[model samples]
Target: MDEIEVEAVDTLDPGVARDTAEYVLYGGKGGVGKTTMAAATALASANDGTATLVVSTDPAHSLSDTLEFDVPSRPARVREDAPLWAVEIDPDDALSQAGMFGQDGGFAGGLDSLLGGAAGDTAEDAAMMPGADEAAAMQLLLEYMDDERFDRVVVDTAPTGHTLRLLELPEVMDSMVGRLMQLRDRLGGMMEGLSGMFGGDDDATEEDQFGDLDAVKERVQRLRAVLTDPTRTDFRVVLVPEEMSVLEAQRLTDRLDEFGVPVGTVVVNRVMEPLADAVDVPDEAFVEPNPEGCEFCSRRWDVQQAALAEAQDLFREYDVKRVPLLADEVRGEQPLRVVAACLD
Candidate 1:
């Protein structure tokens, strides 16, 4: 493979600035550096004096490792001098804490009592429902959006498939809530008749059960609105410099378009660029690739350039940013700052 010379141009744009959107979401296939990008963006936003909270929705939880800090299940300030916070949401814990399945068996128990079943069976069934964990995670996300303490929220979403499900959850959950409401109405007359015979008031219990459902529906609606609003949310798709990753990102963007979500940026991670040209650092930190002499480096560089061309053309309508392949693992604040500078 011959040394291929490609022009380097600054791709960052003000429209996709870190502080432009109140909620910024980074998502793509696994191992494409989505978590690192989210962390760097959040760090940059906070350093600029914006109160920013970075939340991780990935079940494999790497945000804490990437940030080099212990992130609790709930939002906590991670830096004393900066207005930055982080949270790694545990889906099951979020659901339990939200009282979706309380000791009194909130949603599940209520439905079981109305339909006549074992006390815990309904709760178990609800837990087993498809996308239940994602739904719970999204519920917590909605709460965080309503949180007035932070000026911005950046999300590190799960891998491709899980992310699609999480994005689709609002509509799925809304339909489920609507069905439950209809079922309650259908059983309303029967409940009134039974109350008259048994001399018991079920109205209060019914009201409480349906009231929670109504609240959930309202929250889901709000989430949908925020997701579709370009000024409020910016969904950025991250990908490596590879053919498969670029194809996956294209599909993800298409799905987002179908869902009416606004995708404002595409991030190409680990591009093969000279270390000196990529980031400013001490001389010791430089580890430029010898593609001209090494056969393996030359081949990999050629492959990456091909994929980069495809990605650029496919995502031409959106702002695209590239991060150079780093010699060290991007873990601590210093390295993250370097990545943030690349983003700028």
Candidate 2:
């Protein structure tokens, strides 16, 4: 693995400045500053005159608090003067709109009717199915991708597990749907042959049994194309300087590669600045002076330095950007701007 230097002006690095991808995804373990990085990127894009939308797909949304604005389910302006929009995807609402929870005209209803049953699977039960959240989240992302209002979309994705599920959903759903199509063809052919023997109508329309299957297949194909296309989409990994965070990020990067998504950048957030500049020390070690610093800060900084070196060695294949810890929590455009500057 080789490391490279990144050139930047203010908060915009060469990687971001030169990027033309339509979608940017930031994913990592929980509490790793994904939302902050995503928001800062979106804000920088808007400041650079690109129409951008920053969205949070995590169930526990922090976009609102991070931006210090009321973000609705639909895209709303985060600032009056800037060309930036923000929203938090509601999983239940997305599922309902996509017809995943429909009891009368959806998958559960059709299945129940085909089996001649009265009480079918409830919406709650359907929601509990494996990858349900991922499926809904994918639909929401597809909607934004199809929209032409924004030039770019920055996604603050869910934690590692859910994000991986979302990335793998397209292939899994495509295979399942392909099998269903084959079964439908076989059953339809058999039914028609039996009807001919009985002199019954062979052209009866039973398309309702395969409600929206074709559409679903097409959607999966489209999403797969965009996600796997390196020119259109890029995934960035964010982590703090810690053993758990570095290991998790490595695992996430490997999984993304399996899905054929590009992991172009790794952001090391909350890196500690050198304490030696702030605390003047004698040539020899002196432990009795409490005025200059405390033991806890020194110990924590030492640990952070070790973890930082480990992260650098582990992620040497990718472009790494270091962000120092801020004095104040990053909220609103001003604080986000500060972070963006540090990203360089």
Whole-model lDDT, model 1: 0.78
- Across 140-250, the per-residue lDDT of candidate 1 in tens digits comes to 998898899999999999999999887877776677567655665766643332221112344646555556667777887999999999999999999999999999999
- Structural RMSD, model 2: 8.1
Residue-level lDDT tens digits of model 2 in 64-111: 999988888888988767789998998776765655424122443343
TM-score of 1: 0.84
Best by lDDT: 1
Going through the candidates in order, what is the number of backbone clashes in each? 0, 0
lDDT of candidates 1 onward, in order = 0.78, 0.71
* Total clashes for model 1: 0
What residue runs in model 2 are displaced by over 4 Å at the alpha carbon? 1-18, 100-129, 189-211, 274-292
Distance from true location, Cα of 229 in model 1, Å: 0.9
